[model samples]
Target: MHYLLPARLDLQAHLSAWPPTEVPQFHPDALVRLLHLVTEVPAHNRKLAKQIRQQGGYVPLSAQLLQSIERHYNHYLTYAVRSGLLETDGRWWPTTAQVAGKCRGYRFTAAYCTPHPDASSDEVARQPRLQLVHLTDPKMQAKARRQGRRPTLLSPAERRDLRLREQPHAPLLEWLAPNRTPLRLDQAAALAYLAERFDMLPPVVAPRPKWPEWRPKWLKALDRDYYASPVEQYNQRLHSIVRLANRQLQPSIDTTVGRLHTTLTNMSSELRPFVYADGYGPLVSIDLVNSQPYLANLLWNPAFYTKSSSVKSTINFQNFRQSEIYKGRNVKGIIKEIPDIMLVNISQLTHREDIRLFSSFTGSGQFYELLLNAFRQRDVTLTTRKEVKELVFQVLFTRNGYYSPYKALFCLLFPTVDHIFRLLKQQDHTLLPRLLQALEAYLFLHVISRRVARTWPQVPLFTVHDSLVVPQEYAGQVEQIVREELRQATGIEPTLKHEQWSQAVRHDLLPPTSVASSIELNKKNR
Candidate 1:
């Protein structure tokens, strides 16, 4: 069915044209490369054309690559269309850029283009086939290979230990998986509703704030590659949301694997708000305050840890008591009587000199600020509070432990992280990272997922590790549920924080008779 017919279509032969004129002859590989580049950015076709024209150095296209691209772009599109690899509505690529007319653009029918496997192996292949040939420059390929071979800082033993915990707990994974039949159907309906009204939705606001000049070098480097520009990142997120919505609306899960190929969990924070529930309003995110730190408080508490044989049971007990906050007088009395038990236990275990300061710092409900203050007190010359906080987390989460770049600065400035690391080492030298992952899994499976299933089954929910997102109207109820569920699961009451889109933003995005307005109108009518 392919239309581009030639007796022998040699991609290499057309790489360079004989007489370098304004219009360059097109090569199939060059066209494929152009498509791949445009697909990566997906902002504008002309912009991508411009980039290809201006590109220099190794693997530079024929001198007239831009002219060639513009001339034969339609031919390439026709080939892609005939090959069943792309679909477009004949509009310029839909982007957040405030350009006048629709720019011509195309989206991939699959995440990646590859040959279809035989029927025997078809069940294992989740991604659909694309006819386009994959192209990569030799230099870029070498660079990628070099990056892949770069030595990890982790010791051999630590690497082996991490591999054991890499596959999440089976029970946890099963619990987190979307319902096989019904959820798939519901997700489909919800996705369709959202997609139909997508244009009406408010433009996604830029979620990240301006970075300070003194941001951590590591953080800046990471962002430089993947998220060079916040606006571009925001645009990519918007596209991802639409793509996810499309996939979820259809059933894309692998029954044999019992997992979805696409999930809402990986979506950026900014896009979560746009995930509309079938009949509900916009989602409001509710999160546990200092979730990991709070869990650490319970895990390392001297009174609880010493008395309890099972860590899981102790966590359950804590959560149970937390659920009873303000409801049960006995629970309240117990908390009032031993309010500082967690703080005291952690302080003693860490051998921190300032127990009162630590308690006050934890009580202030600003975990990162506590790290910043501790670092400042130690005369660390960090450029910003954010830097200190990021440095501390980088140290704590690093599997390579002290080998991490931020280790020295963090260990010297904040004793708490060092204490936690040392304590985990005493338990088992290779257990620190695994323990952290396990704790996170426990919170997600036992606390958040369970609570959502039991209490808010009717309300659509999405998670971002420690936080939960639900409709804005249900924020108060969901907050209380989260607090109680966490208390029941961990025996500690954690402060919660929430953010919502403004009513104006919501109104602009949502239909006039959307759930938000309908609920308000109904209340007024009553």
Candidate 2:
């Protein structure tokens, strides 16, 4: 059974004829936008049209103008398909069914030919064609009309209200390719078990938690909903987790905005504990400690190299690996101090005595507390350990030569660590955040994911950026494997932390009530 797949149409040739007859007014800007939407990005036809209309400035595209444009667009497709210039299967996946593995619409095969008037026949024949896809379905046409009637933009207040009402969830629109290899039997069973448990789980109905007083002003301004009621925010996260679990699980990578965003990776930390494999016990999460800063330290370690002509050595590298830093410190304590020590070393300041004093404070392994005390001494109004940690993150994640607006605060807090930011930008023109992200992806996909697949083939391992969630029994082995992989990949010893489901459950940390119960309570209260 052969399907009549759509071939590309030569619209440019028809439009560029010597004396054009009844060619529709297809604006160049509109055509370009349409081509981008269909071929490159690949959105639904109605969505593509709405996006084009929304782009119009001053006065938005009028209903009549929009209708006319869509009409011409549809007419072009119809004519091309009918005349055999363009081909199609004459069938379409319904808009509702498109999410369920029916993504195929009209695909672009060839370009529209715009022959030069002075050019020979050979030149005309050699004209390159544009490859594009077009959707020509009655349902899509109806959807477009409905969407046109809807308002495109919302006021700030309306947007805030909408955010409050709707659950905050990343879109789970990506579908795995059908031709991709299937998951192993064990892997498939584990995923299926997790999916079932996730679907059956109830929503959380907990007491509203206090908002963090030390949250950055900028972050507070951006996500008011999160700050307003942390418990409600958590409930929304639970709903998102359920939705993510409901998605089709397969061994395929889905990328968005140059980063991997697969269904498993997108699961929030709050929801990870609830994930379970049938035969294996509840999941445990093991994550790299201070992963981004660790990478940055690795990148800029050479800057601290000493040249005495007789013998050359790096002070930072040697100090970092020394047991003296961890003398009284446990893993967590050592991890917490690494950022501050790295900052002091990387800054390349002239005041070596002051740097040494700051290093002593960091080496105390109570960096955040001491840093907060230092800020208080300088009259810099920082309250919590979290706030100090956020400040450290702000410095570490700063991009290519661009000083954060919070520079004054950071400089006042850590007076001698200003040069480290400049050195990071000098080391790489590309921003540290992007470089760190690429490295993280490489580490997760290449090292961690592969190791899990090979060593514990039956175990259901999931990734969340720098962390991996696996069965609790295998947590120690997984952590060891991850550390070994990181050492092999970057030659840096990695610090690891684990969160067990048993611990969380024993502490009554997981939300006590199910979603259905929460909904019922809300109804009763109303």
Best by lDDT: 1
Task: Report lDDT (CA) for all predictions.
Answer: 0.43, 0.42
Please, what are the lDDT tens digits per residue for candidate 2 over residues 156-191?
Answer: 553454443211111111112212212111223333
Cα-lDDT of candidate 2:
0.42
Best by TM-score: 1
Badly placed stretches (over 4 Å) of model 2 are 1-241, 244-259, 302-370, 373-379, 396-406, 409-420, 423-430, 485-494, 502-526
Residue 175 CA displacement from its true place in model 1, Å: 13
Q: Each model's TM-score, in the order given?
A: 0.47, 0.42
Q: Per-residue lDDT for 4 in model 1?
A: 16
Which residue ranges in model 1 land beyond 4 Å of their true spot? 1-235, 247-263, 302-360, 399-417, 423-434, 487-492, 501-526
